[model samples]
Target: MATLRGSLGEANLGRLVVLREAAGLVTDLVGSEQPVFAWLVHALGSPIVMGGQAQRTLYVADADLVPVGEVPEVRLRMIIEAQNETDFDAALAEAAAIIDVKQIDDKELASLLEKAAEQAFLAHSLALVATPVALREMGFRSMAGSEEALQFKRAHAGVELRIDATADWLANWRLTGISHSARHAQYSEKLLPNEVARGKVFLAVLQIWREAFGNAGMPECLELAVLYERHQASMNRIHVRRPVLTVDPKVFRAILRWMQEQEHKLLDPQGDVTLAFSDGLLRLATGNVAYGCAAWGDWVDDCVVVRQDLLALSGPLARARQIRIEQAADHLGINGLVLHRSPHSIVP
Candidate 1:
């Protein structure tokens, strides 16, 4: 591990300096050991008029070693007269880039550095907010249940959409599960005329948020309304709608049991088993062979013929259940899918 430390400052900005003695300790051990360890700290202090100071640290060690609980070897102190949030962002980006160029080589090390920077930036930004914001104030509230659900409310907001994790919620809405489609006409005939509108709005809201944040975890709910407003125009253009299929609870449960029984045969082949609902039938297919059945009172009618030679189930049965739950959630307008096995329920 080679550590580098330095600082820069401006007249109105507070002075910036590096703890050279500390930095030298880590830099000296760079190529001499099998597992290298480096620690660096950077502090940025602004003038009284610009609000106080913020400190951030970066630490990196070999993946296999237990890290030492000691003070960092290198420390860089910075003071800048940041006029606004943009200035602070620019300064942080520059500092992160400098660290990236100097000591980042391992992928994990780089990720740690990035995470530290993001945390510091978010902390500073949140600190600047004069009034604290709550999720309820932003028209978002969690429902009272074991499963997480979000209720969005706003005047003239079209409809208050309550997104749930379980298939039972869809029953409450009188809607069925559907598959993804590239064309709108494919699933239009199956859904009610009013449902199409509601589903469109629901899906559009989800799509906007998904596109903006991705799987990077939840963002601060305070800014959600602004994000929705910004993306509203574009969301209206989403034409492809997800298909919905109605299934009896007993039938879905039976399918789950059958899947559990054939878990080894379904997963052993290493290819994804795609379960789709269409034409009043639930179909599970992987590779060449396909299976279909219609659910009627806890049992499937017209079960697919199985060729013993072609069936080879492997892997954990829980995985297949998870996939089915996830698919159901996706088609049923549920977000943040979490399948809990102990209670055998899906939570969001």
Candidate 2:
């Protein structure tokens, strides 16, 4: 990624230069008395009505010059990095989308991103994660890394993600969450070339995130870094609390299948499997741990189907179950009997 130092305003230009230089990015005059590199703040750092590819979108910020000739009052700060120049170019375009946002630190920028993501997901019923460039355009400064997923919850959100509260908010907002936390951390580590063993350690800790969140385990440094990297790549290196809905039936089931394929290290040693169900009505609930969190989905049909699959399961446990599975309609409510083994059968 390329870091573009944009300085503006008559108030401060020296601080901007100093911060950029401190960041180890600088350019010199190629042979002219005036340096092309410092033109942003050199002549007189003032908020110019400058424009970019998008008309009237980019406005240089008000700035002040410091004693050390650095621009201290940098109204806007940003970080840019990309896998390649093409990625960087694509990112710049994304940044152009909201170039009008005023100066904001990474945290506020992250909140905006989470809100925007929540809105987008709600509007589309999809899980939409904000890209680094998207965050930058929203006035979020990048700290480090490129693939970090920013984390934060809506300030308006009454509940945190991963709990039933968060899930309920997503439903209320008509949004879907793409739970890439564990999966992304795992995928990111596998992409590393050297230190294969070390990479495994990274995933190992990430695998325990649920346990960590539940107050049962602690994540290691590699896991922390992986999450940190995600945050760094996010708006201002922050986490966005984006409300997301479940993936499509196919994808949701696949996610569960992938989880099931993994060893049961993430779950409590006592965690067991059973039928799951949900409606607008919350009658009986099985905590996430009880259902193994794998093979369980949130869609009413999927849950009812899975519930039936569990009830019909051919085992000693199946005969000894107590949860109610309704297959027929009654005066009370519509009930589903079959707990589906996989999500596909519920739809087709």
Which structure among the candidates has the greatest TM-score?
1
Candidate 2 stretches greater than 4 Å from native: 1-85, 101-110, 114-217, 220-324, 327-348
lDDT of 2 by residue, 1-348 (tens): 112232432332232222322101112211223212221222223222322222111212222233343333433232111123445577667765655466566787789779976554333221121122222222223323522222322111122222101112111111112223433321111122111222232333343343324323332333333543344366454663322122133333433444354425544322223333443222222224332222222333323233333323334223322322333221111222334233333221
lDDT (Cα, 0-100) at 162 in candidate 1: 33
Q: How well does candidate 1 score on lDDT at residue 262?
A: 64
Q: What is the C-alpha lDDT of each candidate?
A: 0.34, 0.29
Query: In candidate 1, which residue pairs clash?
Result: 177-244, 177-245, 178-243, 178-244, 264-313, 264-314, 265-312, 265-313, 266-313, 268-314
lDDT of 2 at 278: 49
Candidate 1, superposed: residue stretches over 4 Å from native: 1-224, 228-276, 283-310, 318-320, 324-348
> Candidate 1: how many backbone clashes?
10
